[model samples]
Target: MEKPWTKSVTLALEGPGKYVTISNTTEASWAMIEDWPLDDAPALNRALDICAAAVEGKRPAEDARKAFIEAAVEADIEIRE
Candidate 1:
């Protein structure tokens, strides 16, 4: 099934590194904002890997969120002040 929001999301996250603006209108999706490193470092790779894994259904969304949150914290990126 094609998802409109997902298409929007692909466009939103199209760059190698960019700000993530998440907004969910469905039960399985939620909103978040993440600033990614433009250097294409390990952190960025990890973030993209996690997102791709989640989107491909290789991992659950909650799990992906947890991974991303952990990564963000490790990277010293403050979220949800």
Candidate 2:
């Protein structure tokens, strides 16, 4: 963990989804985006869109987060186990 800035960031990928976590002081939260089949993973697309928007300053990070949560609920993706 040479990069102190990345200490609070967590990125994980699973068979069912991709995860992105960011925070400060080593405390963070994760957003899980469900990964449906490549041919029809609407959730993943929306998730990526939100991610891009949030990073690009096109949308508020919280709004982007809401989008992901909504998508996850719609897809019935299990985020927290």
Model 2 lDDT-worst window of ten = 24-33
Instruction: Give the per-residue lDDT digits (tens) of candidate 1, residues 1-81.
Output: 423233222212334344454422221233223334343445545655666677777765655555555555555554442
lDDT of 2: 0.46
Per-residue CA lDDT of model 2 for 1-81, tens digit only, reads: 311232233333343456545442112113342323233456656766776766666766665555555555565655543
Q: Which is the leading candidate under lDDT? A: 2
The residue ranges of model 1 lying beyond 4 angstroms of the native Cα positions read: 1-34, 38-43
Taking all chains together, each candidate's TM-score versus the true structure is 0.46, 0.44
